[model samples]
Target: MKNGPLFFFGLFAALTLSWAGTVLLSHHQLGGLAPFYDENESAAFPLRQPGVAARGQLVYADLGCASCHTQQVRRPEFGADQAHGWGERQSVARDYIFQARPQLGALRVGPDLANLGGRKPAYDSDDLISLLYTGVIPGAKAVTHPYYKFLFDERPVVGEKSAVALKLTGALAASAGSQIVPTERAQSLVAFLLSLNNSYDYPEARPFVEKTEKKEGEKK
Candidate 1:
C-alpha cells in the first residue's frame, strides 16, 4: 500500500513538472516574439485602441464565433491561407500579445480572420456587420448561412438616423424578408475583426533604411 501511494505521488510530480515546463517554455517563446515593423509607418500593424476592442472581444466570445471561425493562422502548407486569401506568412505570437485573453481558435469551420482589415474597402465595416447579423448581403439573391437578423433593430426612424451611417449600427430585429441590417453587437464584432491586421506580408510596410545620393547638377 505504501509503494502504491509513492508511485502515484511520483507520477503526479512528473505531470506537474511537465505542465510547468510547458507553460514556462511557451511564455518565454511567445512573450519575446518581435514586432513586424515600426509602429509609425506600418498601417497594417495593430494600432492604438480606445478600450473598445476588449469589449468587442467579449461580444465575440458571447456570440460563439470562435466555434466556427478561427483567428489563428498557420503557414500556407497547413491550410488554405493562400487560396482563401488570409495572408502570405503564418501568424506569429506577437500579433496577439496586446489582447488580455487572446483567442487562438482551434477549428476552421469558417475562413480564418487573422488578416481581414484591408481585405475590403475602408468603409466595408457596415457590409461585414450586416452580413454577420443577417447572414446575407442586401439585394443579394441567396444566402447559405443562418440568419442572425434577430440581433438587429428593424424599426424605421422618423426622418433619418446618423448621416455618417451610425444608423447602420443598432440592435437587430428579425425581418420578414431577407433584409440585411447590421446590429450593434454585429458592428462591435466587426470592429474587432477589422482590428486584426498584420504588416509583415506587405513589403512597403516593412522597416527599411533608404539611401539618397546628390544629383550631378547639384553635387557639392
Candidate 2:
C-alpha cells in the first residue's frame, strides 16, 4: 500500500460513512417512536405520566436512584430477570416513549423496576412510601436499602394528624406531639415509582424462541 493523498481521502470517507450509518441511521429509525395503542383496552399503552409523577421522575434523577436500580428488563433467555419476577416481558422502545428522561440504569444492585407497579401483588403507594422512609421492606431484615427520611417532615398535630402521616414506632419515632409526614416531593417520587409498569406486550418486545431438537423418546 502507498502512503498517498488517495489513501488519506479514502480514510476520511470511510470514517464519515461509518459515523453517518451508526448515528444518523439510528436516529432516523427510532427518533419518532410513538406509544402503542391497544384497541382492546381502548387506550394507548405506556400512558403519559401524571404531573406529580413526572415531577417525581426529576427528583428520582436528582437523587441518583439509577445508580442502584435499572428501569429496563432483559429477555428471559438473556438473564434471570423474568424468573426473579422483575418483568413479564422484555422492555421495548415504545415503553419509554412517554418518558421525559428514561432511567435505563447500568447497575443491578437493586431490583429492576420496569414493571414494579404491574408485578404480582404490586407495591402500593403506602408500601413505596414506607420503603422510602424506613429503608427496608416490611419484613425483610437482612436486605437494608437506603432510607430517605429527609423527604419527610415532622410537624405538630395542628387539629388532627395528617392522613398521610407515617406510623412511627421505637427509634424511628417522632417527638411527643409531632407527626411525621411525607413531603410533596416524596409523594411525587412514590407516585412515579408506582407508575413504572411495562406489562403491556409489544410485538418487538417478544422474546425470540429458538427451536430445539427432540430426542427419539420425546413426543412431537
**TM-scores vs. true structure, each candidate:** 0.71, 0.85
Q: Candidate 1: misplaced stretches above 4 Å? A: 32-45, 120-123, 137-140, 162-183, 201-220
Q: What is the C-alpha RMSD of each candidate to the true structure, in Å?
A: 7.5, 5.5
Error of 2 at 174 (Å): 1.4
- Encode model 2's per-residue lDDT on 178-217: one tens digit a residue: 9999999999998899888887777578665466763554
Q: Model 1, poorest ten-residue lDDT window?
A: 162-171
Cα lDDT, model 2, residue 209:
44
Please tell me which predicted candidate would have the highest TM-score against the true structure. 2
Scored by lDDT, model 1 comes in at 0.62
lDDT of 1 by residue, 1-220 (tens): 3799899999999998998799977877666755456455545344554366677788878878778778776666776775677765567666676777677788877777777774533436766665655566555746755666656555444354433232333334433332334556666777887777763453332223364563544311
Total clashes in model 1, counting residue pairs 3 or more apart in sequence or in different chains? 7
TM-score of model number 2:
0.85
